[model samples]
Target chain A: MDLTFTDAEDGFRAEARSWLEANVPAKPLPSGDTAEGFARHLDWERSLFEARWSVVSWPERYGGRDASLWEWLVFEEEYSRVGAPQRVTQNGIFLLAPTVFEFGTPEQQDRILPRMAAAEDLWCQGWSEPDAGSDLAGIKSRAVRDEAAGGWRVTGQKTWTTRGAFCTHLFGLFRTDPDAERHRGMSYLLIPLKAEGVTVRGVGRLDGDEGFAEVFFEDVFVPDADVLGGVNEGWGVAMATTSSERGLTLRSPGRFTAACDRLVDLCHRQGAVASDPRLRDDVAQAWMDAEAYRLFTLRDITDMVEGRSLGARSSLNKVWWSELDVRLHEAALELLGPLAELDGDAPAAIDGGAWMKGYQFSLSGPIYAGTNEIQRNVIAERLLGLPRK
Target chain B: MRFAFTDDQLLFRDTVRDLLDKECQPEHVRFAWVDGDGRLPQLWQSLGEMGVLGVQAPDAHGGLGLSELDLVLLLEETGRAGLPDPIVETAAVAVPLLAEVAPPELQAAWLPGLVGGGSLVTTQLGGPLVACADTADLVLAVRAEQVVAVPRAALRLERQPSVDGSRRLFRVDWQDDDAVVLAAGSVAADSRDRAHDRGAVATAAQLLGLGARMLDMTVDYVQERRQFGVPIGSFQAVKHHLADAMLQLEFARPVVYAAAWALATGDPDASRAASHAKAAASDAARFVGRQALQCHGAIGYTVEYDLHLYLKRAWALSATWGDAAFHRRRVAEFVLGPPDLPDRPSRSEEIHHG
Candidate 1:
């Protein structure tokens, strides 16, 4: 359909552009791989939240303007266009708040929604145990009833818990009935990171960044009120949560566009590799892919505004876009050449080896939420009416 | 602000779909394509009577005054039907240009016959290159800075077989005494470019139709063909490949339609949109054609099977005006900067013999 925005939407874009031009910090925020750097990024996020610019799609009652999806997309494009700091509270604003608003009780919403909006309580997902990843129904994390304590005791481990070390709250799934069917007996819960017996151990990636962690929940007590949706219905709630994560987070084409822009700028500035036709072709293809992805995302948003739910189609976008991101960063690494092997402490490192770091980070994209293999299966069976293999 | 077709447009699409289903069945297309002299006279006359040929032509030119969006809808349905006709060429390309550049007397003389299908006309026959010197009642020929209108009868026409059996190419010999040169200088150059741009959009529309037909044919074939006691379509690899094909088709559909919409609305960014759409459609057709043939195996390559015909059309249509690389380079230029031009001799002394 039509990809161009309306005049009113254009006005919104103009206003957003002006505001970002006036307010974006002169110094770029440090990339959020190290502890201190991530903390500083969180501070910048808090400042944005204070200015009520953190969640463009949330309701006005929840400290947002209740803007149209087009406006929200415009905000994202404008924000990323100006190289604003990455939203440190994305797990809170994009993931948790939407789920809580839909499934959380009134009191639960009151408790979590405002803090998430204000970035007062940072959040991280507690999915993906060491053994259970694509098959989340096979999770072994358990939360047994404690009659005397008037709550449940969660005792298990969660690996690949992104930003687990720094977050104040963890939203997760736990086995409420060990004897029930794998997907039938789980319960969604929110546990404070500082709860008694909770421990977070950082997992250093190849980039030597502690962005991921393994969290051990040792008899951590979570009140019944912390349960998201009905008990034993965590599978459904997790579906909703994971759908939002994959759809909203992975399909943000503006992110890739911004990355492509930076890569192009870097290529232009270096000038050494611009002579390679293969590299140039790769860059051009990446740019085209990003543009197509952005147009597709715009089409989806338009459908939503017209009251169409994309349902499983969102998985198609998620898989396609994540692979595109990998392609882009891989091209960046090739552009950087042998310098990509050098890391943070090297004297001649390129942009602190951000390209190498991005390459490593991109490796996790097709693995997290749902692997690309699983996404293909979804597209085949659900979208294409293929028989089960 | 609405991004969707209106009720009338929806009805128009439905009518076109219904007509194609009845008149342009695969069997009919295959029969006419194989037996006739590349022209389906009876079917063409019927369509003309049904007002399909004039769907987008101005009423003043003895045709219905419809938008380019309506024309796209008809093209998509024609694509779905695997229709073999030259309605797209005569209506979309020839008539529109004639209305724009022809003298008022010439417009009054030829447009009515062209729209009514009383006078059959086809585009210039060349290998992915445009030369409107043959089959056209009046050739819109551009030489250097001048655009000339030459009578087709005055030019010698030599037919050449092409990969796309549905269309025939011709070599034209134009005598220096039989041309009516129109505008010259920069105006001619700009008009020619604009005409090429419009031709690109129309060709992309045709490819879109071919792509959709190929997709449907492949899907149907896979659904019926059995291997090891199962429909081959049930296989994961086959299903995934077809799904990917569908994705390309659907994505390209919107881009094509968007360009048509821009052209219809006379948007300032029409050329850019048209190029984007053409590039996307060309890639989609090539991709879908390859996969469709692959899915059909040996039979798809056989002459008896109709899949090869559609694939041939797809290949030929994609290369027309410009291929994917050309359009992509145009996009790159737009994004980068204007390209350097080569100097050429001026056409100031060129004469109009007519």
Candidate 2:
């Protein structure tokens, strides 16, 4: 119940803050527009990995300090306070790493976790297909067994694969049995993007960045050892992955706090509408929402540490914080005013119009992981005990 | 760092809960609302006898010297029982403030009676409008730079029956030279802040109790009421609504507890935490009350039913101390700094979204 840190925690906070102050780059990683810019961001992520501060929560065997959740929270708070680069390996480190630890074979954990921790093996999610966005159980992509080849041939199209262009690996779901029930026959697989049959096509966003890609797999052979958990248990694995994704990674308030701080600074530096009451209120509300989300996350983490299951309550957190992130970024745009329209090279370009880009980017937040509508349904049914439709 | 009750505190909570369960049933509350003085005299006496009223006051002042957390637990159970009394007003409000600021003579005179449940006292909170002033034994009236204590008999009471059937509002006037002035000047603001913090936490505890009861009532009703040849509780819609209410209540409870912890532990940000608790609890109470009534269908609205009593209490308690909007604004002031005309955009021009 106490929000203030204890003396020991305060000492750790001081240490973390000093380290972050000394090490955090003076400028943000170059905006992920050009391939070179994206690569530089990856390099910065690798630097954090080299420093052993990349994934603050992972065990030492996996290249982290094996810090307590409280310590991890403090690390995030310090990292955000200093405007450190957002974790570029978030998809691999935050989402898949936890899934692999829980369900992957020991060998799988050993092989993948270090690479993930080191940012050596950048990863992209292949969960959402064109038709199976919110209803992931409806995925039609198939991975048929090639017993003679000691593998399965995965053939499917995954749309909205974030950062798919530069990623080396894809952890995804595919239908293993065509005739089985929609959710039951799926199998989770880890496929190398460099495999001969895989192809990635860039998808241009409104901001004109190819941050998302459509990954196509044609008879892409994935070894049987790469299968996560047991066959036909992909639904459960996907649920685990989705829960972690939706609950923890997608709505990390620490990240939002940093962004809010940056937005406030941008407003101060840009000297346009810095004193706008409406904009200030928007920013203030965003900050408050972020704080609330942080407290809620702490409560969830406390529950987890105490062996209590989050269950559907995580959906409430997901819905709440996702909307907050969207609103916060949208506030940044309003603060920018006409400057939002300028991108890249315009004289009025504000941080390459990152606020505008983020506003557009935030739109997909509620759409992905699970649509906000679906989340509401989850809250209503699972949390609220409503009748099924 | 521990967010749980101590063993003694747990026992105290259980004792109060069991006592109220046995004595202050909703049926009793309903009866008292219609026939008696809307006061549970026996229940109050039972609490006083159990020494619950003295749980948070100093031992030197005829009290137990318990923590704010202990008081919150008691208040929460009282709220859950729907026991209509001045436990909060007399114990939480008047006793604590009097212990802190009252003249030595006043403290000696009032502390023993309040702890013994021999006298009831309430404050005249000058909210957006100052309506309630008459029913109190002593009024904690706020002037520009001072909070003066005036006897209730000296002021006039303008009876205003609220949505909450158990409590009434009053308007009073006071011009007595003998009236006690507790904290004055800068001390007044500090005392007001402390009282506001305590009021916010207490209100949150009360809301938690009311919200929990509404949830329980809704679930029980849904379980019994048949729809389409089955209990409506079996319906996912009803279940989900109840689950959502449960979520709100669960979330708000911890925040309220946290606020109480902050206050007891002397945390620097106790004010902010208290405001957070108030805002969260106020929202939960409103949401849970409406949902409870909705789930119970037509029977919930009837005066004969006990559900309305819980609803009335929720409404009244929410407006007490401060409402959700008021707390939100207070929280906003803390986080965003006070509204500056030249520094922020006008409210109308802001993009509004939920």
Listed models, DockQ each:
0.29, 0.29
Estimate, for each residue in B171-248, the C-alpha lDDT of model 1 and write its tens digit: 666776797766678877666666666667777887888888898788788878999999898887887777777667
Per-residue accuracy of model 1 over A1-389 as CA lDDT, tens digit each: 35567899899889888877887888766667568878888778777777778887888777787888778888898898888876778887888787898899999988888888887888899989989988889999999999787789999999988888778899999999999999999999999999998999988876577888999999899989899999999999988887787785434877888888887777665675764546665676667667767766766776777898877777777776787888988888888888878886699987777778778878888888788777777776677665664
lDDT of each: 0.75, 0.77
DockQ score of the complex predicted as candidate 1: 0.29
In candidate 1 the C-alpha lDDT for residue B48 amounts to: 75
Best by lDDT: 2
- Residue A170 in model 2: shift from native, Å? 0.8
Cα displacement (angstroms), candidate 2, residue A276, comes to 7.3
Off by over 4 Å in 2: A179-181, A260-284, A334-345, A349-352, B1-15, B103-105, B126-136, B215-254, B288-307, B341-354
